[model samples]
Target: MELKKKLFPFFSTVGILIVVLGLYAFKSDSATTERYVAQTRWENLKVLPQNISKDSLDYLMKNYALSLGVKCTHCHVPSKTDPTKLDFASDEKIEKEIARGMVKMTNDLNALYFQPHFPEPKPKQVHVVNCVMCHRGAVNPEKYLSQMGEMYKTYDPNRDNRKEMFLEQQKKQ
Candidate 1:
């Protein structure tokens, strides 16, 4: 009766303190975890500029991942001994090779077309095509614009006859 009433408030306060401390511990541990540590260290970057800082590399990599609606592991293979550790230099994943081709294609497309017609000078330019132009934050774009997918499926980039075909089509029109 009296004991229950007296201890109830103390027990409740102690329980809440325990829970708060546990939550704080979890938050702190996660904040200092290996993923955060890895983000601070960079090595063996091949495609991007070798002089690029870790922060810039991380930002660009994150943007690419978000553009494609994928996680780091989508193009990276994790270390067998430490799952949190990624082999950034490894080309084990085919998606990584595809991404490189996409980057080159985007650069070529921008250089050949949009850059020339710029109303303003570049290093200032507009209407540049990036992954987001078609991807819209997806690996495979959503169905509303699936014609883009069909076009890509039927088109052969390596055939190198795109310019000829475009001119032929224009002549018909």
Candidate 2:
């Protein structure tokens, strides 16, 4: 019984040490990978963190991709010199510019709506809207009023007579 008691304490201490070491190794390995887009050297970042670590940047990008059901190439364009590598700094892709605008819009909406205005009592959450709220893992969300599709028809905004004349000529033939 005395031998078992002594061994038990030693084993417990070793187990705790092992767990701490394992966690430390995991955290360091996850954060220290070489990043093409460095946290400090970022440019053209409008909505996302201007100074974000590589791991954090990757984490956020993954969430955004999952939210929209898209790959990174949906917003970021590949380098012309090397198609495999992404041109992170370039805004040659119009979608990237549009994404910045979308981020701003969503943040603004959250600021206005999601924030609680309780003076006396504090609320639980600062629950803000994310892209996933609307997207639900889709590039384009399915229309709620799909049945009313036929009701809305395109009207020609032909203020000039040229478009009308062109259609009229086509009818005669």
Tens digit of lDDT per residue, candidate 2, span 1-173?
99999899999999999999989877855444654443466777777777777787898789889988899998888888999999888876666766676678777776677655644465543447888887788865545334445665763333235434655777799
* lDDT by residue for model 1 (1-173), tens: 99999999999999999999989877755545755543333465555667667777788789889988899999899987788898877876767777877777887788888888766556543437988888878886654464554667774434434445655777799
TM-score of 2: 0.56
Q: CA lDDT of each candidate?
A: 0.74, 0.72
Candidate 1: residue 120 lDDT (0-100): 56
For model 2, the local distance difference test gives: 0.72
Residue 86, candidate 1: Cα error in Å is 1.2
